[model samples]
Target: MSAGTPERTPTPGQPRRASVPEFGHGMVVGKFYPPHAGHHALIAAAAARCATVTVVVAPSRRESIPLDLRLDWLREVHADTPWVRFVGRYDDHPVDYADPAIWDAHCVVFREAVGPGPVDAVFSSEAYGAELAHRFDAVPVAVDPDRRTVPVSGTAVRADPAGSWRFLSPPVRAWFVRRVVVVGAESTGTTTMAAALAAHYGTSWVPEYGRELTAHKLARLRERSPGASVFDVRWDSDDFRAVVREQQAAEDAAARSSGPLLICDTDARATAVWEERYLGSASPQVRAAARRPALYLLTDDRGVPFDDDGLRDGEHLRSWMTERFRAELAGSGVPVVELTGSHTARLARAVEACDALLAAGWSLADPIATPHTN
Candidate 1:
């Protein structure tokens, strides 16, 4: 009789509830907008009484933070909790917070996603929380520690993140402070690829860190430094260092989240390659920063048809850039998994390589395969 064992019981006009000993497997559903302290307390309480906890992260029409970011927030808070699992709501059917039908659908989806288990209870604070419990044939435990009396909502948090964050747990707050950056040459599909990988892996990504910094620099130059002479960005400038540092910091933060893995399109190594090629020499600090990547992916210049993004500097330049990147990586003695050929082929190859590497005992913390079709 472990503390978290499941319990069972029969109910009138409802699905049979498992006996007390069968309540070990529990399911919790919430927006967890930022997974505040209150949310953590609820989850901890549930964990104490359950062998396993499944968290259902449902999308709120009232909240704007993407589902992926919210998922990241949760992972960061419960990184060490092995018994905890996460699932996002399906986009097709909107679940009505007050509808038992919706809750029934959600429970079915949850069961399918997590597989058959001895779930005997549902932990929630929604208006129909009890109904959901009945529909799922589980005991309902509602804890409204926030005093809001309404659902502990992500919408409320998004309205005033700083103010409402007090409702979130400390772990959620820490996730906000952490950042995840995706970097690569223009038109290298860094942004798209980063988004895709994040979605596939269920993590968060920091938007282009360099673009924001560059925009800020451009704005500052337009204002106080209006007449400042435009210098080639390659010249040693504090601006360049600031951008590099920002990008590096973002990547580091993303890596620390509870998500099983975080994927970055680019790393400090890519930046160093750019600086060395454009500025003639990379700063020692930048060179040192480049070594922080847990794994390096060198995309091959396999004549993948190029699109005119204006920012892309032709295939010839890309070929040269690829060569330089290889040379730099060689000098640093960092092993790189090179991906070449058509994008479709390359992606497939990458998946295979990753599967093989994972099988061989490589750390699953980083990308190890580049899928490329011949």
Candidate 2:
């Protein structure tokens, strides 16, 4: 099961539903190109009226967002209502409400997932609700015919996700959040830059998990050998793997709660670089853990003085580390913004890069357009 969203006030024009549980099984079908509040409201309304609801989250395989992800988001959002069951199917069949054969092809897929159970009511906010209900031999119930109540659509959201940010649930928001990662050599101010950028954007930032692991290892070493230093801390491929896993987990968690943009001190890609610095070379698994982020802010160690925190012993290797990061990042294909100069200047440059990334609106491929889309 997916994680549940925290209890919060519903978005305006999207009313919360109270489960009265009157009818038998109800059905709701949609592409849910990117499930938003309006979609949630429709599902909620269905769950309210019926003892059980089967939501057919059918989208073409050609669509950008995966069917599994939509099902996950919907399942997580309505977790409180266990009666609402979510199912997915790749309905690549051509959509044409006027065509009876096309409708039959689509209904076959829906019926396959819904099983032989009778559908008492078919709920939808589209023009084809009545026809769909007629085919299912169920009552047609329209939730919101006009766009006034929930004034957002998949087309509008795909066009401008940032503008329709409020309509998205936490899980959906996390999917759309543009992750910006900051990485560099020791004392190059990656953490400072990350936090500064998050502050500037009024969003959440992910702190480096590798550093925390380093501290933990150092502390453990000190317990056995009191005189042990940061250099005495032993590292293996598994340690870097742990760093990569933990870093990504933290980044993903932050993305769920963050605004449109999320800032991070380092990511799995940087963890691979750290692995190379410690071990001879990055392991295959470690290298594979490097998931691409939206942007990377590589802090240049050109003029920045190195401050040796208790866990860091890389002052002498700062230049080498910086160069290695640059080399690795260059081939990763992610947009890199090298921050060099005074702290103030670096922040200004970071902000400019992030702003540009946000300005370039999300590019969600248009789903196969139907005459009446839910």
Candidate 3:
């Protein structure tokens, strides 16, 4: 049942035999588009009954997510299930369930791909799938089409991504939530670096969640005190504290909504850094809002170009800014990987550092030294 062994072919004159459990093989086919809770339930159920489970992931044109992303989602969700094997539906074979010949051909290809083993059963959701399994001479284990018992489907999960994410198993949710929040200080290329990291890793990047919170707080303040100054409204009010909490929740929600990874432009810690530096001290609530990131990426101020975003203090003060932020972070005992060089060079270094950290079994919270390459 392991990946490399060859399957035994039945003799030409012999009858097709019912697969023996001793041979230890099973095949499960589904679209598995992002592999929601229902898919996991079915796979786990099937895996319990069989010695080996070959998951045939059929590509769907209607779904927006890429095939590889779906596969990664499956891998992340089923990391503990060593008996599970993954394979793509053959491109040469048609996906239509009505085509019995095509299904048979796909079965042959799957059997060959997994090495020669007697396939004892086929686990699926659709009626057409049951028919195809019968045609392949395997016992058809039909998963509930409505998934009413499991009560989660990929379509419904996709429709309300954030809300429906609670339906996923804990491991899947954890994997997703950790991949998003990329935190850094102002003028350290948080926005640029977030976008670049997302592109490099092929994942979604959430823009600064705090912007909306800030805007909302400003709006509420304007309503309360029409003539208040921008600083007075933002810095000297309870509204700022509310905005900080709101921003943190939004970032966590964004992480739960997407898979692969979500690169966040800034986090609550970045907001706190500015609040303390400019306002002398953050409000008690704002101070409480500042929390350590899953992975803290510190960028050195090597005089990278800065644009006037109305909020930027310009490149001249970057060294001072970097020093203050570094001191603030150091006191918290949170480890940081300081990225240096040109923007592109820094980004490349960050990626390498992250990869190495992950390879060495370090999670986001674990402190790791930033690697420097000549």
Candidate 4:
């Protein structure tokens, strides 16, 4: 249900600092491509002075981030303010601040979403704030016109997410976090690489859910039959499905709290390879669960000693598994870096790959251009 502070009326001759609001209804409209801290502060300032505030989170259809996702993040960030309302509409109309026809076309979309009203105040920080307020026949209240308070913008964020990381809320950060997955054959140092990368970056890492599932199976078998071994554990299509679901859920949860980069031990695509090892074929469902990560670090089995961790397969299967992983990942579009040699050397190479990815920065398509006018 839509939630916000209850609508209220200004009391007659009340003190300015009292509970009474300055305006009956206030409106805040913007593209909110990603809704950074500056956007939040503007809405907060409006909510403080108005009895009720309506925020229109409008973005063009060509934008990468879905419109509903933008609205969801804005609502989550402002959930505590019950008097503030957030609505979304696709404003695909061309942006030409000086053109009256373009302004009228855009205002029509905003007005329909805000409902029939007396919008007493139009709160904004854009150059068109004065004209927008005049169209609504409301007072124009500018907040942080010079961008000194928050010191961030959607364009700046889209250009360099890591630099503007602090300006993004948790949900927005989760969407921006770069996921780096480490995958390899048994005893090929996948876990070690993932943990080391997380430590080097001081970020959160997700452990292999498939390993936890394997241990659980072994423990359960031991409970039924005394001294059960890893070999006794059974495999089924459902087991791989569980791994994919749990792995994805864990990665998503970690992304919200992780640093600029998130390290993952093994992802769904690796699980599909493991499924092929045991079942001779990868299930359709398991293959579908594979998602594209920012980068993939495949720890080559060569030169790495096989250490049976009580849950790993025999040493002979390591070479076959490594080859299978290589063949499968070849067609995957994401960048894959094969880590070989000593642990130290592989870690150094992995670090270089991660640094390069972050350095490249994000590439978001430009929004409708508002030509500069003198």
Candidate 5:
């Protein structure tokens, strides 16, 4: 027996009833190109009206975000909706009705995705809702075709992910990794600032992966060779590549599961810095990934007390490293937000830059273009 109490079969040639929520079962079909807040709202509204709502994600081979990712994302966003089931088909199907065969194929796929059910109503915010509903012997409920209330779409997000970032949930945002990188020399508070900024925004953050590796290397050296202090190999090219790879891993993992704004303590670029420091050159992969973020927070060591964590090269190399970072940024064309003064002041300054980006609809394509600061 179906979970929804089945109604009697219609009389011969009689039309099946068309009321949606009033009939206990409802359904919604969407591509959810990237699954933004607007999609969530639509799902929420449908779930509210029906006793049980089965959401069928439109499948396609041409999508940049894969169908599985979309399905997983939908599951995460609607996890609390036990009454709402998510479904999808894996094959070469149409995301848009580009060809005549798509309509027939899609109808078949839709039915397959929503098998063994008497869905009373079909919900959508597009013109095709009526046709889709008609095919299923259900009523059509168009929620918001205009997109006024939740003014966002997958196309707009794909074009400018950073700009449309505010519309995306963490799962969607994670795929893009709109990085806000805090970087500078030793004792410049890069680690401290990244944590504070993440906390300020109530978001997740990527810690300094290189620093973690350095700790491990130091520990192993001590265990193998007693009283041996040097852990300089941590900055070697091969090891730096490891740092870059692991840093990328942490960043990748954090991006798919973090809030709208994902913060990075330091990024692959830092590996390039270590490369130059030890070997007078940078790794190819690390150098490539060293592109500027939505914002480059270059920390200034001036007037700030330099408290060396045993790994730091003391207050001596602070100025040199700061200059190296500046020189690195000099060519990237990325707008720099130079942070100075006490931690509190720097945090406030960073917030100013971040707030302006959010206000301007932070674009993932060119995050730092619309520069703002005091």
Candidate 6:
């Protein structure tokens, strides 16, 4: 299992890669926090040797990404491999492999998940694999414990996910989403630009949920009172605040389901503009939920037609709101991508911004701060 464990050696001159555990049924166990490329290589090494392999997905409560989401990533990566299967056990058990008491508890969990089996071999990249395999009555096969085969680690990926994007799976990459928010005054082609970017990138987009809610609420109000005008209805900051929460939830869910990048029609950063127009001032929750985007494309509403959707304050107010959004984003540390000219030109500019963002990634020395201010 380790350097001096009397294990079979790999082929001569190929020290980086390990030989497969030439056995019938192999087992691998790991927390698979984000299921990176190294995890995939480890599973593949086991799959190469055995007729079948069981991958136990162990997750603790303290993980930033939820257990279910991590499991989802594992399933997505290894599901198509005929020889690989997945099992899981989420518990608060200690992960201290060096401690005998902790190892005993882990053995009990592993025994239950593995069930009754000969367990021809146990595969891992840790020194503890020797003891774990001994408990299972199987030979321990260590695969690239030095991590030379796959250089990336889960901790490194978590720290600067965008910089280490190649190691992550598509599903897990969703968690490290470089959210690009297209926001500005109403009728400025925000929806169109967001959709175009998503389509270009072959990913999903988070539509403006607050606007959708506004349309729904207005429709119901009109249904109840047929001849009532906009002044007949009265709403408060609490209503918009609730909409911000919904928008945030929608964006989070979309991020889970989307690809490497998530395109947002608008996020909490723009909720202030809406709240200010209707409710005098923005809600505190809006600033709280606002996140720093990888890139913010502020639509100028230049040559675009200004049409009211029954909820807007008309074109006359669009310029002022645009200025307000610009002011709100001016001092924020997030990178801004100003869009002008035709729709095609705007889309091109947005695509260019995303390409640059993904290419450069976040520098360790400086990070854009998500300001929690009005």
> Best candidate, lDDT-wise?
2
lDDT of 3 by residue, 277-347 (tens): 55666666676677665566777766666665534443566777788767766776556777778887888
Compute each candidate's TM-score over C-alphas: 0.44, 0.90, 0.48, 0.90, 0.64, 0.62
lDDT of each model, Cα atoms only?
0.54, 0.86, 0.59, 0.85, 0.73, 0.74
Root mean square deviation (Cα) for candidate 6: 11.5
Give the alpha carbon lDDT tens digit for every residue of 199-298 in model 1.
6545555565655654555556668767543231223545456657887677556544424234566666677766665677777777666644434556
- Tell me, what's the RMSD of every candidate? 17.9, 4.1, 17.0, 6.9, 11.4, 11.5
Give the runs in model 6 whose Cα sits over 4 Å from its true position: 1-33, 37-121, 125-138, 141-171, 229-233, 362-374
The all-Cα superposition gives candidate 4 an RMSD in Å to the true structure of 6.9
Among the numbered candidates, top TM-score falls to 4
Predicted candidate 6 versus true structure: per-residue lDDT over 120-163, tens digit per residue: 89998877788889988899998888889777766666556654
True-structure lDDT of candidate 3? 0.59
Candidate structures ordered by lDDT, highest first: 2, 4, 6, 5, 3, 1
Residue 342, candidate 1: how far off, in angstroms? 1.5
Model 2 C-alpha RMSD to native? 4.1
